[model samples]
Target: MRMCSADLNLLEKWTWNSRQNATYAGDLTSDGYMSTQQLAQAWKQKFPGLLTDNRHDYLFKFVNDQRSSTTFRAFTEGLFRAQEDTYDIAKETDEKLLRPYKFCSSWVKNVEENNDTLTQLRTFESKQEYKEMITNISLRLGFNYDIQKELVKHMYQMCRYNKAWDVSQISPWCAVFTKEDLKRLEYAEDLETYYKYGYGTPMNQQIGCTGVKDMMDFFKIHVDKDTPQQPRSSVRLATAPALLLALGALGARRDSAPLTADNYHSAVALARRWTSSTIAPFNANLAAVLYKCTPNSNLQINEQYQVLFMENEKPMNLEECRVGLCNYTFVKNRFGLIADNCNLDFCNSATKTTGLIGFTLLFVFITKLL
Candidate 1:
């Protein structure tokens, strides 16, 4: 008892409180340990996030006990160890910075392997083909048809934005794509072919959740690859400006019509030169664009929930799906693209200014700034 720390003191207090002034301390539990209800109530107060008031919550499952002294002792020890281990703020901040990478990597792998929408991307060939695929997948996955085309199309547009192409034999020259595609055509040789066909976006969605620090690291990777041609100053100077300029120079203005074959073909030609090495961050950006084309509809949703469900086995209702739509502002802020007011003006202006300066200083290294 003398060696028992503050946690033990608190545990004793909780035990006594649970007994409600009973004469004997042994009255806390018939088995001489706190009951599940007592442990749950204590955990709810101490670790509210871990244990909701629901009958079968996270902590209850974690401890795996209706009546067990082992779980109680482990829980008590964990809290004490956590408190003792987190003394340095700097260390905690470093861990916080590194945490998202682990989360993003784990999340990306899970979704790529599991999400039916993304998986369906590999087999896509034509609009009709995709519609049929979606119909089948919806039936197989227990998704209702009311949300079928909407969900499938959401993923379809993202695939296009990511530079995936229609590789089906049905229409080899078709510029327009559906949710179905055999392979992404993002790595073409000619500018016309590449712009028309290349999956110019990054290989994965890891970009959607990264920050400025991660962008800097990404630049470092390209710098190491392009050492003789790419100087550190040039890399830093060109990135932001190049993105702004490419976006500004975009020729095709968005329209209200559902994207037609003609519309897609023309848009790709107009923005052919406007390429991205890492298009993952643009997932949210593209979602924002699609939302404008059709606001307040299911088509406007981001892929976060789609990806999240791949890692988590928890079932979600349709209402929950509709309610939990990811906001454009939220996504931008998550990736350090915006500052206050959820406005892109600050970031855009800064990038444009820096891009111009960088362009002047590093003219030779100015190939594909974004």
Candidate 2:
């Protein structure tokens, strides 16, 4: 582990790669983020006038805005637009980096078939359409981040025999991965302390129960047969979504009673409360409370659960689901997941993926630079 940590020190730049979880370990393995900070700091150091937050925001907009550009109208379009089935990132990195990964032919074929599906999602007219898309993905693929979060958190809570078993989607608190530092067997106590203090606020009444290093321990036990049928749903949470899924699974066995319609509503209500009322960010524990209450065999809640999913089988917006008298069943009118669509950030919210990617990429780049 010490040797691997040294190697991460050598690599120079990277970020918490969700696709390659745990491989990076903790404490920002790469310089991607630092590069941005360094650049920001440098700019601040160079010009005091640009230090203001609003100015920085304006500068960010000006860089991307064509109206502020001196170049021709078609020039900027060509910059961001893909050319000849290749993106700018692809072209730039194609020669410099020997691309180690490529989608299999089968994956591409599936993508081709789903082109329209992607188009619908891309051109989704409203929030309702987007939420419907989320549901469709969950229903068909058994991939709802919320349900998956609930289940994984349950797993960890129920089966968390040790600190190694705790972890939910992309744990920032956990150490970055090192081939040598695969397991912190020596400093398990410190790891546990970090978790306890780092994730102080509880989601599913659990704190410091997440870390990337526990991935190995999670696969060894929680993944064995006879486990719940929907582990794959963890992909939706993106980072901690996967960890939370495992945690949800581990946490469930700790449940005092099985989730049912009578108690399930409260679980859902609690989940809503955690999400809305609490100051904490999203986590698997919150997810567990919501789905754990989902009656396992009771068809009433289960059937109603189906409606919770979109036609495509994806998850729905939790905030949109009102606790008082909101329809637990699907209500649609040509507008694609209409009832689930109203008043959502997913639809109108812009900084959905770009901001995250920008910061993460910068973090990785800076790691390399440093």
Candidate 3:
């Protein structure tokens, strides 16, 4: 059976209210999908000052991209519009540079689509701790027997979303879970993510090298003496999975050993580096800033330095350089394994064509026999 982190029913119920609050009453369609116009209006409501100068009619035209059905594109475009900048569709389309995981068929087949990916997650659900948590939640709700896993899961998701959307007011659903119980549930989620997206699988990190390479290439261009001094920025938006992959590639907050169901009890002590809430939470970000240092007697001319930040905070120091600033050359040398050969690394060309060739040979043999 396919497992989902959140219940669809709870999502529909919660999302409807959130979307309604953002837009007009009855703005959503029967299927709960919003039109481009309604989406733009919702964006305007969320950031009232963002589009003050732009005309309302022009806003609709800007966000209405028929090629993509999802509102994600519209939201991204809205951000660029707010900043008076153009969204680079071409750069975003460079899948090899920005999203190498898309080319990794092995990762898709072996990890993502594979049932074994959730082995630890399934194991955790069957564990005594997990069962007791469910029972306790059911008892809290005044139920005689244990509540269905699906219902409890939905409750947890509702609790999480309600708190995330509005932090001041606690959700009624959250009352069922105590502080300890919430921690357990959160660990369960961490297990799933660690295996599916984080360092449990090596390919996840391998594919993430594309983003690392892109960053290095950008830094190299600016750090070069021949390169002109100008204000430059590289902004790449990606999902949580991609973010986790990139983090794994950078060896950021990596545990000494992989997190598994067997070690669930010792997670706090053993897996200190593998916390999903801190590493890849809602709207999580990882950034690398390059600074040109002033030439002192000890420092070379045009000396460039780099610093890494996660969620707007400097979490750790680079071993190769000083506590805050890492030399550019050292940083690039460390990530030298990340080459511009995503297709070679990710795309399993031989494996992909083997089945087709075998089938064609079989067909030819049968034709000769006939």
Best by lDDT: 3
Could you give me the TM-score of model 3 versus the true structure?
0.68
Q: Which residue window of length 10 is worst by lDDT in model 2?
A: 355-364
Query: Candidates 2 and 3: which is better by TM-score?
Result: 3
* Residue 195 lDDT in candidate 2: 25
Per-residue lDDT over 1-370 for candidate 1, one digit per residue giving the tens place of the 0 to 100 score:
0212443343234321233233432122332222323432443353343233222211111112232223334333333323232222111122222223223333334332334323223323334544555455454334566244556444444333223212222221122232223122231112221222122222212222222333333333333453211221111111222222222212112222322223334654334432333321211011111021124346654432121110011121112333323343342344333212222222222212211001000110011112
Q: Can you give the lDDT of residue 7 in candidate 3?
A: 35
**Each model's lDDT:** 0.27, 0.23, 0.54
Residue 86 displacement in candidate 3 (angstroms): 4.2
Candidate 3 — which residues are off by over 4 angstroms? 1-91, 226-231, 267-271, 295-304, 309-311, 316-318, 321-324, 340-345, 349-370
RMSD each, Å: 26.1, 25.8, 13.3
From the highest TM-score down, the ranking of the candidates is: 3, 1, 2
lDDT of prediction 2: 0.23
lDDT-better candidate, 2 vs 3: 3
lDDT score, candidate 3: 0.54
Could you say which candidate leads in TM-score? 3
lDDT of 3 by residue, 136-173 (tens): 87776667799888798888877866665556655666
Candidate 3 residue pairs in backbone clash: none
State the lDDT of candidate 2 residue by residue for 1-370, as single tens digits: 1224443343333242453344333223223222323444443343343232221111110112221121111222232232232222111112101110011222222222335323322232224433443343234323444234234323222222112222332232222222222211112222221122212112211211221112222222222432322221111111222222223322221233322212323554234211211211221111211122244454334322221211011222333332311122322211122212322222223222211000000000111100
